[model samples]
Target: MVVKRLSALKRFLIGRPLKSNELGEQKLNKTKALAILSSDALSSVAYGPEQILIVLVTLSAAAFWYSIPIAVGVLVLLSALILSYRQIIFAYPHGGGAYVVSKENLGMNYGLVAGGSLLVDYILTVAVSVSAGTDAITSAFPSLHPYTVVIAIVFVLLITTLNLRGVTESASILAYPVYLFVLALFILIGVGIYNILTGHVSPELHTPVGTPVAGISLFLLLKAFASGSSALTGVEAISNAIPNFKDPAPNNASKTLMAMGTLLALLFTGIVFMAYYYGVAPQAKVTVVSQIAEQTFGRNFMYYFIQGTTALILILAANTGYSAFPLLAVNLAKDKFIPRMFTVRGDRLGYSNGIIILGVCSILLILVFKGQTEHLIPLYAVGVFIPFTLSQTGMIFKWVREKPSGWMPKLIINSIGALISLIVTIMFFLTKFAQVWPVLIFLPIIIYIFYRIKKHYLAVGDQLRLTTCEPAMPIEGNVIIVPVAGITHVVENSLNYAKSLNPHQVIAVYVPFERQEENDFEAKWMKWQPDVRLVTLYSPYRSIIQPLLKFVDTVQRKASESNYQVTVVIPQFIPKKGWHNILHNQSGLVIRTKLLYRRKVIVTTVPYHLTK
Candidate 1:
């Protein structure tokens, strides 16, 4: 009854499903269903061009102007890729993305590579898009400067929670706002361009933004392309979530891809044309959409509305990541590359663990960068293109192996995508070395480590399989050993905590770092009454682990004399903030590890919460 009431309350809070039966088949036609996926793809319009313009500012205005060609190239490539993915949906309707396609057609290693790249790309998409949105907000209101990343992170956490609740809930909540933003954007761009073309427009924020460089050099053009390519980041989300659509996955996917392409082209072209016509140099310091709006709308109500709408769009942009990332995690989990928690869905049928993980990671990124989108912009594209290049190549391989009846079209289209993505990736790499290279190396190393973990899990599972039900090991006494460093709350808590467990015997063992520390422990020992007796172990070398190990070993040896158990209670200070964690408790970790490996000992961690 409580569950049903909660479900009803949730439904009331979010909305009723698009279909009558909540768990039944979706009744949304291909067009309607396509809108949800397309929204994720199309929402890139909000910050995609902004990313390009921001990057081009590194060069002169003339070079920044060349962002036009880069935008056009990206749009063209986007169309080609959409067409290619259409073939992918048709070929693998069961929903095999880059990894599945690569593994089935190419090899296992290629598949793992694709999965790793995709996972990194998914994480980057969240960071970049949210950071970009935060930038737009900061641009409008300078007071929001330091808080942009904080706000963006809050939004990430909120969106992740919403997604964990369910996609249908999130879609219903976000769909209208996203569509409204797009509509508002299209109207603004369409009318603004028309006004500029008819010579009825005034100058923009960076009016007549001076060009430092003369002609667009090859390097300049490549940089522009790399920046503009950020617009194409979320295109694969539709393919990733193809299974979530209504009936006819292929048809829905194709229609969604087409809508996304059309919207993307219009958005990129419209924004570029507006900025170009008004001489809004791509490499200017006019940070916010408000500045851009003031240039056009001239500090009117429309300006405020535009700023508000941009914020709305940017916040929802994280929603794209929230929805898509969980699916990627689920895919990786299925392949046993990620932990199985990602595969478990909530009562609402959403990947809850995956959502929380993405939220926390994105929040950390936003906090670390202090919500400054400009600084993070450089690192963004690196993670995006890494997977894009690998995925496109994987598709080509998939096309080759499963040479379907009409494989020619897919072959040619995916071939173009692969070639373009490869070139763009190279361009981005060359353009973004100082800022982005570290991320490129770091993400892959982390991914490879996860792969190793997967391998180890599988190997260990097989090795540790219990062949037969052996007799239960006899209790070796409940002798509790209290690991003490000094007489802090951590130590007292450990003493009280071990006593609370009601063990057979509790002995407080202290590693004397200095005479003062030993003296302090003795002074504080009588302040509280614990059932355990205290013992001081001297360390001549000021070593923590060795002394703790020797004490635990002595207890273990004594335990054999009388079938008693030994439980080592290590007192640890848990800091409220991460910075505090770095400073405190270096000795506790070492002691805990040493005590854990003893033959017949149980390790208990008694953590006392401490303020920074």
Candidate 2:
């Protein structure tokens, strides 16, 4: 009854389970796919521009203008990544992304490294995105500042629940918020640009004057570039999740990738350009986008609307991680790098285990970092860029080895991407070494765990393989032992079942805590004359299961020496009420657990239902 209620509650939460045939229907079209897959990249515009100014602002107020060129640099890298991933989509449509590309071309260790990095990045994506979303909210309403961690965790759980409901369902629900954010940003950028071009708003009005604290150097520019490169964090997600697209999956996924890249470039460029024109600096609580909106629209409905949509899209950005993490985990699980449970689809045909795991990890990160985006930002880009480099390099290897038609141009694009990504990775390590070192430490540990999991699965495969094994043979003899607490209907039922086994001998064993009870039990057994041999082993310390286990071990050893199998039958009474279970001891459960690994010993249970 409790199981039924719990199952009903699950159905209510995630909706009815879809049949296997409905899986194709769950494949997403380009629009919904854009919402589900591209949201992380799209929503990065909310904070990506600000991350640049955060670094540049440290130099001087004049350093703010440098954001324009840095944004341009990031856009150039974005183009290369888009082109390279488009080729990746066509080349490897089955969609393990870097892990598949690297494994097939570069080897298993490289593949594990790429897979582990992406998994870490996906987790950080959830943490950073949700935390950033909460920041937007706290910016809008200072009253919620104290609950940032709670709010971030709530958003993580919300996205996780949406994903668990199934891909198509989540896509449908999240599609509007993403489009709303895009629309809001387009309006903000257009109005802000128009106001600037006309004499309505002066850029000089908002510009600040201050002495330079540090001179602008190549290293500083690279640091700013590395920070802003987080905008490209979700670019590879489309390639990772090509299988989630509708039929002609590769074509659809590629189209989505182009659409995402185009929108991201436009939004990122507009925001950064306006942020420069407006002379907005990163505030302790307010976001750069929020500042731009307020400067342009003066805290009107449009201002709140932009903030609301930004928060929504930022929260929804976690959908990309939700979409890609599970699919990537499924691929890893199929290859035996992770647990096989991640490969199993839930009732809604989603990788529920992977989604839940990602949610838990993200929540822990939010808690540990107190939902601060700045703290998480350093860990984010390095994880993503490592995979970006590995994936692009893997593509280079693919083209050189496969040398398919037009492989030269493809190789060139991926080469540029690989080189740029490698440089950015090195820059992240050098610039953010203090904050990003933990990622370096974590990557090796995760890769080691992957190899360990692979080894275990391989060992299990070897043990369970049937091709080289001999056929089974019938048992020469059987000895059955029944353990009883006292003579009752439960014990009688077990003895009846034991007699039905047609064993060579049936012996009933009992452990008595006191001599009086042993004498009374033996007298009762003799009076009943049940025809089955009865034995009682006295316990000195009032132990029950210990003596019974010792005797069973002895019986099994003798049976094994005689080429006979031993089966131990245990009698248990099932109480009518669920809470009634606590009224009885779990000796049967304990014995079963303890003897589970003993070879040639079979344990069976005879259950008698209780009326009262």
Q: TM-scores for all candidates?
A: 0.73, 0.96
Candidate 2 lDDT tens digits, 1-612: 777888898888899999989999899999999988999999899998999999988876688878888998999899999999999899899999988888888999899999999999999999999999999999999999999998898889888888899999999999999999999999999998899889788757444433244577899989899999988889999999998999999999999999999999999999998998888899999999999999999978999999999999999999999999999999999999999999999989989999999999999999999999998987888889998999999999999988999899999999999998998999998998998999868889999999899999998888778975555546788899998888799999988999899634999898888899999999999877468888899998988878888898898888777688888888999987778898889988998887777766888989999998
lDDT of 2: 0.90
The Cα error of candidate 1 at residue 309, in Å, is 1.6
* Range of the 10 consecutive residues with the lowest summed lDDT in candidate 2: 205-214
In angstroms, the error of model 1 at 109 is: 3.3
Q: Which pairs of residues collide in model 2? A: none
Query: What shift in Å separates residue 269 of candidate 1 from its native position after superposition?
Result: 1.1
Please give the CA lDDT of all the candidate structures.
0.69, 0.90
RMSD of each: 8.0, 2.2
lDDT of 1 at 259: 81
Best by lDDT: 2
